[model samples]
Target chain A: MENVTKTLDAKGLGCPMPVVRTKKAIEELSAGEILEVVVTDRGSIADIPMWAKNTGHEYLELVEEGDVLKHYVRKGGKTTDKEETPVKTITNEEYLEIADKGPVTLIDVREPDEFAAGHAPGAKNIPLGQIDKRMDEIPEEGDVYIMCRSGGRAGMACDTLETFGRKNLIRVAPGMGDWNGPIE
Target chain B: MKVAIIASNGGLFDAYKVFNIATAAAATDGEVEIFFTFEGLNLIHKEGLKQLPMPEGKEHFAEGFANANVPSIEELVGMSQEMGVKFIACQMTMDVMGLKKEDFADGTEVGGAVTFLGYAKDADITLTF
Candidate 1:
């Protein structure tokens, strides 16, 4: 049994709650410390590990006791810096300038319906959630620019692509929310 | 940050707020969960798209939003789910309202007060509307 620095009782909570409580509980611990989360939401079995991976925490183990689940996570000293990526970002104005100069690969990471509602003319629709499984769909050779309703999902997509060694990625900040360009 | 939202109102303005905040929080890596009870359950009903708006005082704003290409409540709900925000409908409320599992939009789970309370207890922030 690992030394438990703290324990969060999230039993009966569903979906994101268990993960949410675990995140806060982990924050209170010091580097290399351990946090235990007990939850009854079966979704946490997958959610916790994904959250740990996304946030760069160590998912030590999961123990199922009866209908409850005990998850052990080791606090990472540099969790805050783990998500930092070297991807470059460009302003919407700069993106428009570049697009006007020549054809640019613009990837809209919003949902299909959102994309259908309105999107930059000639932009490719590859939603952020499906980016990982659909990476191959993105051309390896091009100046790839990503955008969402806002710049947030685009930033996340840039980080995800960076991890996969995809360079030449540029994030369009102040995305569609402030896009003055014509929509398709 | 962890935000637990208890939405008990079916009003469009309130539903918009719930979806907006939930999606925003998720975007910033905050874990978010919304529990819909009482009238709020109507927001997730299959026919919710038609009944989403408040009955008064917001029609012009709603029209403006539509014309501006702003997302509707249904679209916002979809966006929130894409951002990993969890939407849960109250089971006891469903029973009282004669709603079944099929009555809600896809991706909604039915839960009880205990389940929602469990979430609120551990959440860093909790709000009711």
Candidate 2:
């Protein structure tokens, strides 16, 4: 088998850094080529395999070379277009625009502790736990958007709404952590 | 488990990030809901989450969030809705922003603070993004 090999020196990079570098390196290679990724984060040890699967690259070998972790990935003959393509997310200006013209309902899915700390100026506190029973409370006229620390719980809230047949919903991308714009 | 997202940031970055998270959560058979507030309200604006700028030295905030396995506000909304996630927005913020019910993302809700808090109160895990 013909194989072209490249080395990625991502030893000190963080969680997504190594993955990004690895993806970039692979993008430059042809089928049957191998990319060797050296990373320092132990998280990569597990992330690499998932990346390979998610990206359609074949994960050949993963080894712990002392404190550094190494991964060997090969471009497969078949392309995996099922992989996700990165997209631009919501922004501060757009957020204002949407809110400016919405017959929508907004909920702050963060815990009571976090909500008390500080949140968007006029957001409601619908902690994730009580959403089910309180589903009736959410207005029936407009859409709903759920937000939490980062994007984790918001995603959860989005999912719940779908199950109850409450169509027209969204999550605050990047959640509260990324909201640098004006609050209340 | 049920899930919800708050897309408070106002650009494509948050829109897409929220979507990815919803997809992942829905894949696990979890119900999802997303509420937009503050700047997050912008995600519902017409084509609001499109072509957002990438921060200098940052490959676009949304891309970074995606590369990190995080969801964009819009994407979360779409994916969650596809897999059955509910979406919402803040009515107070809308009023303050001089917005109307018709201006938000097609399916977003305009709600209050207590509404979200009500949900967060009993969730297995609650987070603020």
The number of the candidate with the highest lDDT is: 1
**Residue A53 in model 2: lDDT:** 76
**What class would a CAPRI assessor give candidate 1's docking?**
incorrect
Output the worst ten-in-a-row residue range by lDDT, candidate 2 chain A: A79-88
User: How close to the true structure is residue A21 of candidate 2, measured as C-alpha lDDT?
Assistant: 61
Residue range A1-184, candidate 1, lDDT tens digits: 5557678998766544566567667765555557899988787788788778767688899999999999998876532122365558888888989999988889999889989999998899998889998999777787899988656667777778878889978888767877899899
In Å, residue A147's CA in model 1 sits off its true spot by 24
lDDT of 2 by residue, B90-114 (tens): 8888888888878765666667888
Clashing pairs in 1: none
Per-residue accuracy of model 1 over B48-82 as CA lDDT, tens digit each:
75577665865778665554444567767776776
Q: What is each model's TM-score for chain A?
A: 0.55, 0.51
DockQ values per model: 0.02, 0.02
